[model samples]
Target: MLASILMTVRKRRQPIIRLALSTMVAALLLGALACSPPEPVRIGFLGGLSGRVADLGIGGRNGAMLAVEMRNRQGGINGRPIELIAEDDRQDVEVAKQAAGRLLAQKPEVVIGPMTSAMALAILPQFNTAGVPLISPTVTTNALTGLDDQFFRVVAPTAAHVSKSAEYHFRENGLRRPVLVCDLRNKAYSESWAGDFRTAFERLGGEIIAEVGFESGQSLAALASSVLAEQPDGVVIIANSVDTALLVQQLRMRAADLRIATSEWAATERLLELGGRAVEGLVVAQYVDRGSTSPAYLAFLRAYRERFAHEPGFPGLTGFDATNVALDALAARSRGQTLKQALLTQASFAGAQSPIRFDAGGDTRRDTFLSVIRDGKFESLQ
Candidate 1:
């Protein structure tokens, strides 16, 4: 009888031990919950933040962070704060790829952009392979977006802009026997734009007198003199602002009868600032109005100035547009849509530059606006 009583006591002890252990585990879990911090959803900005294009990216990042901050102030998406991780591409393709890789390692919900067509093209294949969507701020080569199901952009295709410019200037303005000076060997955007200009001009019954390929380091004076000797009707330059401005100034000095037209890449304040009076009467083709009167553009311009203490250019606005779209996708992650899909859904976005809308093929086809420099500013050619 005594042994049976002892066995009963031991069984009671076993239950008490298990109950105490469960209580300790529950307390530990509660403690962990109290100490752990909520994870913020990481979004990556891939761009040339420190090189020649720093102005372009700084303004873009500023605009995007403003949007994110506004969203966060509203208590965030599903109680998760959005955080931005910016990586500098230095305007180089190899550097862009490395920057993208670093961003992907952070496992961002979406990647903003590499900013240059060449940079975007170099980094997209990796993101696509990983099923991560990339949204370009302004790299509009069309080849980047139309390549796969993963790439997208808020900026209208630079190629289409080039084509439209050629169409209007060659057909409407009667610019026959034009000189084509393109930055062929630098980036795909320029090369493609040059081709489009040639095709459109010839199709409109205009002749290309001389097709010249100038390197980034070539002297604008020499190039202008060489092209002027050909006695062309107009000058079509498919290059960046650095080269474009130099060429414009040289052409202004050499030829009074020559008309100058630059592509989307040359749409920067640097052109007007550097080219000075030479940029006057020069036509620039772009997807967005430089001096836009829309409320959205005005508001964005204000915000960008407040954040960065300066005005935004066309590239900066494209960055903001791309960022806002990507952020919208990220905030809506619970709805089973990706950054690419959200952008590609043909949703019209009132961007700082223009009303941005992208097709299913990741191409953004928008109306081109022709603007001319007047009084040191770009004015709509009404």
Candidate 2:
């Protein structure tokens, strides 16, 4: 009887051991599957995040994020979630090159932004070599206009707007003698803008009193004093918002009745906040018409305000447009077509600011507007 009882006990324990072993094997398989990598469609974003030009970079990054979020919410590209790898170049050329390399390492299908023309030029070789399409949102230099590379921009070259501005000031405003002050730090855009404006103004029977340049980390007060000494009828300031505001403040302090105009680069809201009353009545060229009532523009404005808790400026608008271009290309790719071919074939992209139609040189023709700062807001002068 004792032997029979022991045999029953051993048989019951044998089944329990088998059951525990089976549970352990199943858990292991589940864990392995959980640790597996996810497949995602990647897009690389590079811009200056920490530097004097951080505003532009931050705006661009936010815009790109908005695009990514909107696409993901709408089921993403062919059900594969889109990923954005953002890198800060700190507004340095070498840093931009390294950042481009790091972004390219992930093998992203497309890249968006370097914010400035200099950074775009620095990182162009990397994207071109890797055969990745790069869409620059705010690079306005004419240097890359006809380059047969993968680089493209949402904004038109500086030549067009600056020339128009020159005509507006000389022929319309009757500002015959103007002084040109440019920041060498962003020579890629500023220099081009100043040069184009000078050419156009001179051609339109206006005189450039003096052309002065200020480098980064230099004293703006002295530059402003020197420019004031020229007693120009109107002044054309070609610098970013920060420097532009400083120069404007200095100029206004010295001469209360001074007339000032600026390039599109310095036409952000930050300029009004920084320059205060000094920027009032200041003429500036802008790529976006703030008075647009289009459905696309209004929708973008609403979404941007909700996400970022503020208004979107040129940088934000252009960034959003550039990313949309990239997303459209990605969508085409999902249907077994390539983004490059679509872009080169003159893809029609409806942007928040305007309808985009790429030309043979991969540049878009945008309508720039003249605006003046009135009561700390941009009022269209056109």
What lDDT is reached at residue 44 by model 2?
A: 85
Q: Per-residue alpha-carbon lDDT of model 1 for 193-277, expressed as tens digits? A: 7777888778888888888887776677888889999988888888777678888888888886578888877777777777888
| Candidate 1 runs further than 4 Å off | 1-37, 171-174, 335-355
| Predicted structure with the largest lDDT when compared to the true one | 2
Report, for every candidate in turn, its global Cα lDDT versus the true structure: 0.76, 0.86
- Cα deviation at 195, candidate 2, in Å, is 1.8
- For residue 250, give model 1's deviation from the true position in Å: 2.6
**Can you give the TM-score per candidate against the true fold?**
0.85, 0.89
Candidate 2 residue-wise lDDT at 156: 89
Best by TM-score: 2
Structure candidate 1, residue pairs in collision: none
Worst 10 residues of 1 by lDDT: 51-60
Q: Count the backbone clashes (under 3 Å) in each candidate.
A: 0, 0
For candidate 2, the 10 contiguous residues with the lowest summed lDDT are 332-341
